[model samples]
Target: MRILVAPDKFAGTLSAVEAADAIAEGWSRTDPEADVVTVPMADGGPGFIEVLHASLGGELLAVTVRGPLGDPVPAAVLKVGETAYIESAQACGLVFLPTEADGRTPRPGVAAQASTYGVGELIAAAIDAGARRVVIGLGGSGTNDAGAGMLAALGASSEPVKAMTSGPEGLAHVASVDVEPARERLAGVELVAASDVDNPLLGLRGATNVFGEQKGFVGDDAKLAADAALTTFAEAAGRKVADAKGAGAAGGLGYGILLVGGRREPGFATVAAAVGLPDLVATSDVVVTGEGKLDWQSMNGKVPVGVAGLAGSALRPCIAMAGAVQVGNRELRANGIEAAYSLVDIVGTEESFAHPARSLAAVAERVAKTWSRR
Candidate 1:
């Protein structure tokens, strides 16, 4: 029997690579003779580069860039041939935001001020490395500035550059934007905005309204202010692409990319094509894909659902293993997941959270007892 294990990062606990390894180890315990193939997955989020590096064998060029708070942060660019892959999370992810005294809650007020200047620095590094094509993975962001800082760092000028380099709050004060220089900077390069969501840049389904709270916009007043600021920036910048699919991704970084001639693509699809996942699913007898959580959001172009689509197309049985399962079996089946298993169910929530790899492995072992045909 042959099994394919592919999973995205388990958020705070396990990376995509670690989750894949744990699943493979546990499945082997129950079916030692079974052939297991592991593939780590990402949806343009925190583990984007790591997963791609594993499958593409690229050169990782390390660089230091500004973080969301204007401090230096470590990041890397993956160069494979003439193309460069960059994870936006490395520069402005929520993980990098300063937290409160509790060490978990993101510090307040920063949400409205978090900047994506570092993302632009990473792009500069990629261009400097001779990359003719750049693919930017946009998700898990901490900023709500609509990529104003990114445009500034790339030579787009605004009245009082400081206002533009700052976050949404600052953009509200800016009067005009000149993006021609930024466009000229990428004259010969092809830019691709790889995003997990297809939201537009404004309105209820947009950036500030839908994603600002997680970044620390606490109340309706704060959200409204941020939205207004983003609207002001959008007016100054180009509003032509504000409604484009993925324009709201990574706090409107997708809009910024479009302003500079970048095209949008589904992050999972981009990774899948690069890793040749369709062929892998076609040859496998069973496909197992998962993530940290299985919920309504999982149905929306996340890694697990993306993998299920591939498995469905290939006529393979696909199951999901998540740390916590919130969706019922009926909904899971509707999404192409034949069956679903959760680590929190097999082991207690405490044990699962405290030792994710071990807990997940235990769940996989139990699943193998029932699913393994050998």
Candidate 2:
């Protein structure tokens, strides 16, 4: 039987490629004759750069750029043809910070002080290299700033950019925007924002309310920051930003991209098309996908769900194997997931983290064994 192994990164533990390898290894032990094909997937988040590089042949261009707090950091951009894939997390990712530094405990307050200047630098670099299109994967960011740092790197005035950080009532501070410098630098380039979430700029389900706490914003501060950023963006662009789809993504970076004439698309669809996922699924008899956690969010434009949908449309069964499966099996089944399996349920969490390879192999072996009887 032909099996397609396509899985998203297992968050802190394994990358999508590694997860696929582990599943393949375990399945091989059960059925040596199984024809397995592996395809690594990402949700346009932290692993976006690596996944794009692996799936689409690209050159890694390294450069020195400003980190979240204005510190110099080493970052890289992936270039393919006249297009470049840029992941914002490279410069301002939460992982860039240590749990403890200079004898002090780290806190989420650092996000407010972070910047996306480096991402802008990467975009500029791609433009200088003759790139005609720039695909920015927006997720796993570490800043709440309304892309002020990025605009700054592109020579936009900080006065108007800083207005985004002012209190909600001060949104009028952003009276005008000068895109002259940015337009000069990125003259004919098309910018595409590949975002994983569809949350708007402000509201209960918006950027700060839904994702700020994970990046460090909490209580009233989250709402305040989001509102201020959205208001400033709307005022500067002379349009409503609060209701814009994907506005809350990557701490309002989506709005910034939109302002720069960028188009927003589902993260999975972008990555999948880049990797030729539809063609792969069409030829496979069974498709297997997984993630670190499979929750309700997985149903909302995540890579695994996207893969399953593609596979189902081709009349193929899709199985999911995850570190933890939060949603009910019935819900998953209704969404084109034929079966759902978890490493946590079989191998225990401690053992899984300690030896993710072995734990994942065991999970795949169990899946193969169960399917062999069918």
Which 10 consecutive positions of candidate 1 have the poorest summed lDDT? 102-111
lDDT on C-alpha atoms for all candidate structures? 0.92, 0.79
Q: What does candidate 2 score on TM?
A: 0.91
Residue-wise C-alpha lDDT for candidate 2, range 1-374, written one tens digit per residue: 87889999998899988999999999888988989888899878988988888778789899788877667888778889988888888877776654445432336466655667777888888888778999999888877665656766776663545653332322335577665576566668899889878887766877667777776665686557656655665666535654678877887778767766778899999999989999999998788999999999899889888999999889988999999999998899889998899889999989989998789989999898876433
Model 2 / residue 279 / CA error / Å: 0.9
Off by over 4 Å in 1: none
Clashing pairs in 1: none
Candidate 1 per-residue C-alpha lDDT over 1-374 given as tens digits, one digit per residue, 9 for 90 to 100: 99999999998899999999999999999999999999899989899999999989989999999999888999999999999999999999998888889777778778788899999999999999999999999999999888888888899999866887889889989898999999999999999999878999998999988988888888899889988898998998989999999999999999999999999999999999989999999999999999999999999899999999999999999999999899999988898999999888889899999999999999999999988996
Q: Largest TM-score belongs to which candidate?
A: 1
Residue 287 local lDDT, model 2? 89
